[model samples]
Target: MEVKRVRALAQRALIRRWAEDLGSPSAGLATVEAIRSHLSRWVERRHGTFSFRLTQVLTGHGCLGRYLHRIARREMTSSCHECGAPSDTALHTLIEFSAWGPQRHSLAAFVGGDLSLPSVINAMIDSERCWKEMVLFCENVMTQKEAAERERENSTADPLRRRGPGRRRLRYGHLLLPP
Candidate 1:
């Protein structure tokens, strides 16, 4: 019941309509207020490494994706080159990447064994999981991502690869025509 109310309150406008939802600060507030309310009510604000990293996952802002594309137009492809997956969203990386199966499974079990993104977020502070474990998970995900980026950079930087046609592949995958 409370979970349903929390989800509903997170919707901004519906927050007020759910008059019985007066317990949560987001029950009848603006969108920004609702966000701030949730942060103020549920999340800790002080300096904590795990919470800082977790917030990036919660807000859908960390790692490679559309946001990374925006930040580094040339460095990142909108789609994942390694997996040939479309969008390559943060959610996809966290919940769908095949290579992350083991980490995901362990993290999912730690959270609630559901493996759903929403469940994972809701379980952020659940008694079943510890914050340090979540932090380690986030750290591992980031380490893997960083290593992939470095590998890609090293591959693209090598200049000795021979091309079949009269074209060349640059660091950003752009083709160079023969002189």
Candidate 2:
């Protein structure tokens, strides 16, 4: 049993080391670096959990659309549903999407528009208003993107509809009437 435990621990350590080594060399990997910077300071919090759970999204890459899609295998492409940009990355959602321009401006003003991950994290730690604005901006973008995806799905003719129109979809835990 002791030998088995030692073997398991050794394998885990090896896998971790290999993963870290392969973590880099991708094109346009600044977003990953920025996320790392935020996480590096996670333990030494300059402020308490300000905006609450939303801050977790800001600190990790896995919360981004690309990672989520990749994990779920929902679609072949990880492109932004709004703009069709490649791999709706965290940086792209936060910095590049023109759809959120107005909200970005508001959040940017609070955080001084640095747009760096550490800066945003620091701003959240430093001010509750900044934390709130950041959370609102991120949440707004996600909500808009999800709404757009729903619109796309609804617009596309369901193959079953060709069989005839007695189709219903569940919305808000209730059945939606057919058009």
Candidate 3:
């Protein structure tokens, strides 16, 4: 029957033989064309595209390699000033860190309380999850420092502002009746 013929053709041994023949250096033009056509069809069906943030973090700003080096603890030009841990890699820093554990936990909570690092990265790279958390991990240290500076400036300036003529002050003896 036709079913039996199809089953026999689909057998592993037959498929291996066909693959070997096609992969052989002496494969014919027809075999090469068939392989190319199959690959094209597979690509079309998959519809794959590169993740944007992944590309940026990995290559755009040199963060990926720097992070990797830090994690590995190999002699690097610089290390994370906050934790003093030799920043190994971006993945390791994000996933495995004693100091950053709390921040990572917070981020995981934001993303439905799942702390899987790969999942977090996938979400970040796809731009569908809280990727800002990752950005904060790298850049928000400066933000915190700036905030502290602003607070210090405001505290120092408060007394001066209170004493300036622009601020109206009422003396206890200056009470007057409404006209």
Question: Which one is best on lDDT?
Answer: 2
Per-residue lDDT of model 1, residues 6-66, tens digit only: 8766764554444335445432133233344344323432333445545555444555654
* Model 3: per-residue Cα lDDT at residue 116: 50
* lDDT tens digits by residue: candidate 3, 1-179: 99988876677456566556656544234324434334323233332344444333333223333432443222233344345555434444456656657776777765556545445544454453365665555454324423543554466644421223322335533455666
lDDT of 2 by residue, 25-118 (tens): 3643553455444443443455545343254345433335575466534445677766788878777877888877898899899999797776
lDDT of each: 0.56, 0.63, 0.45
Clashing pairs in 2: none
Q: Point out the higher-scoring one by TM-score: 1 or 3.
A: 1
Best by TM-score: 2
Question: Which pairs clash in model 3?
Answer: 67-88, 67-89, 68-88, 68-89, 70-86, 70-87, 70-88, 71-87, 71-88, 72-88
Question: Which 10-residue span in candidate 1 carries the lowest summed lDDT?
Answer: 159-168
- Specify the poorest-scoring 10-residue window by lDDT in model 2: 160-169
Rate residue 141 of model 3 by lDDT. Answer: 30
lDDT accuracy of residue 99 in candidate 3? 62
TM-score against truth, every candidate:
0.56, 0.57, 0.32
